[model samples]
Target: MSQFVIIGGGVIGLMTTLQLADAGHEVTVVERGECGRESSWAGGGIVSPLYPWRYSTPVSRLASWSEGAYPELAFRLLEETGIDPEYRQKGLLYLRVDDEARALEWARAVGKPLSRVGPEEIYSREPQACPGVEEALWMPTLGSIRNPRLMQALRARLEAMPSVSIVEHCEVKGLVGDRQRVSSVETSRGNLAADQVVICGGAWSARLLELAGLQLPVRPVKGQMLLFKARPGLVNRVVLMDGRYVIPRADGRVLAGSTLEEAGFDKQTDDQARESLKASACAIIPALADYEIEHHWAGLRPGSPDGVPFIGRAPGWDNLFVNAGHYRNGLVLAPASTHLLVDLLLERSPIIDPEPYALEGRVGHTA
Candidate 1:
């Protein structure tokens, strides 16, 4: 079995580690901070892309596969680790308050069964919504998961693996080897050897690759999100209004998000972004106007020129692989990404083509 050293301990890294360990490979996760505290913890936990069908076919296929894998994974993790990821199937209710033509076309393109719900039906489904809302597109298969809990459960599962080791507060500085192959990683802790090194550092992917004398064209897109104290049943399902979304959890807390800013690695919460999200949330469900805002934070999504993530091996390097640039869909695509990467590493046929997710395409592809 090949010994694999994975950089970053976010959802992608942890999930990949789990899959590798399950395949009986020796794995070690080197994390800069506590596991899963980065973008994985800060994501909205939406199980699909903002618009699944509008994305590339490869992206849609991977997302769909990951969504299907989530239920079984959640159940197994809950049973083994005694922690629930709160995987809910409440479905997504997308309101087309402005763009009816585009919404209908997108719905049709996705091939998912969608029904146009009038204001009365929408109100009946979610009474807390504001008046003057025209119609909504209901996609019943879409849902969300609690990110923090999922990360916690993944950490517990990884800890239980006899062949997996986690070294926290271990920031990777650079790679140690020639241009053709990487033999070890230079971390703040020390030099650690590995048969192969997979970089899953999320927003920091490009910089990490630069240390190995390769430039990955990944940018950090900043997103600010907020949480509100909501009553159970206040919002029965996830609501998408224009570009904003309000997600209700099993607990009484509602997630009001988010603003996508082209800020490079700036994770500070801005007051303007927070207020704008609040305004957008209140516009969708006016009852939220009175709800107390619980928390406000920001995260950096590793965005590529195109929406597709950069997976597979970096060009010119045989042993160095990359799995970053997931951007906003990292949580939804985690399972399929891990499955595909493991298959590639073991020389097995992947469920989908790995060409679209290749890292070399990042520099040339424009979206």
Candidate 2:
């Protein structure tokens, strides 16, 4: 069995480690901080991208597969660790902001259920959240999971595996290898030998790959969000207006987010962003204005130029692979990305065409 060292302990890294360990490979996760505390934990947990039509075809395919896999994954995690990821099919309520025709066409092409909604229908469906809407599109099969719970369950499940282990608070400094392969990775603790290494460092992926003499176009896109404490069923489902969204949890913690700012790894949450998100949330659902702002934070999404994640072997280094640059949809794309990366590692047939996600030119591709 190959010894695999995964850099980054976010959802992507943990899920990939699970796949490797289940395949009977010795896996070790090297995390800079506490596991699952990065972009994966800070996301809204939407199982599908906000506007599926605007993304690339490769992203839609990965989201399609992940939409189906989430239910089973949640069930398995609950059964094994007694922790529910709270995978709920709350559906998506898209307000009339953009052209619905493109969305309808994309939904038809994807074989996903889409229906037009009138103002009355919108009010009837989400009276508290979406009071008045001229037009809307309802994707009833869309779902979400609580990301924090999902991460906890994943980390617990991985810790239970004898073949899987974790090393937290240890940052990877660089890599020491030759032209043929990467023999080991240099961490803050020490150098660890590895048969293969996978970089799932999310927003920090590009910097990590620089050690291998490859410069990925991946960069940090700061997203600031706000959390509100409301009563249960206040914000019934996921509500999207313009570019912002409000995700209502089972416990009534309404997550209102976010702004896509190219701030170059700035992780601070300012009052400007917080107030803007609150205004947007209140505009979408009037009741959200009354709730107290429970939390405000920011996360750096691994932004790619074309909004598709890179999941393939790195150029020049045969033993190094990358599964990063997922941007805001990493939560939705995690499962399929893991499958494709593991397939590439094992030299098996990929679930989807790897050309679109390949690191060929590094300009358009996500890797």
User: Could you say which candidate leads in lDDT?
Assistant: 2
Residue-level error in angstroms, candidate 2, position 351: 1.0
Model 2, 1-367: lDDT tens per residue?
9999999999999999999998889999999999999899999999999988888889999999999999999999999999999999979999865778888988888789988988887877788865546888898899999999999999999999999979999989988889669899899999989999999999999988888878888899999989999999887789898989999999989999999898998899998998899999999998888889999999999998888888898987789999999988999999999999999998889888888898877733223
Model 1 clash tally, residue pairs: 0
TM-score of each: 0.95, 0.97
Model 1, residue 343: C-alpha shift (Å): 0.9
lDDT of each: 0.86, 0.91
Name every residue pair that clashes in candidate 2. Answer: 310-367
lDDT of 1 by residue, 1-367 (tens): 9899999899999999999999999998999888999889998888988766557787887898998999999999999899999899888777764555665676677676666888888877788777777878777888789999999999999999899999999989889998888888999999888999899999988888887777887889999999999888888788888778998889868898888899787899978988899999998888898889989999888887777888898788889898988878889999999889888888899989998898774543222
Candidate 2 worst ten-residue window by lDDT: 358-367
TM-score of 1: 0.95
Clashing pairs in 1: none
Top model by TM-score, which number?
2
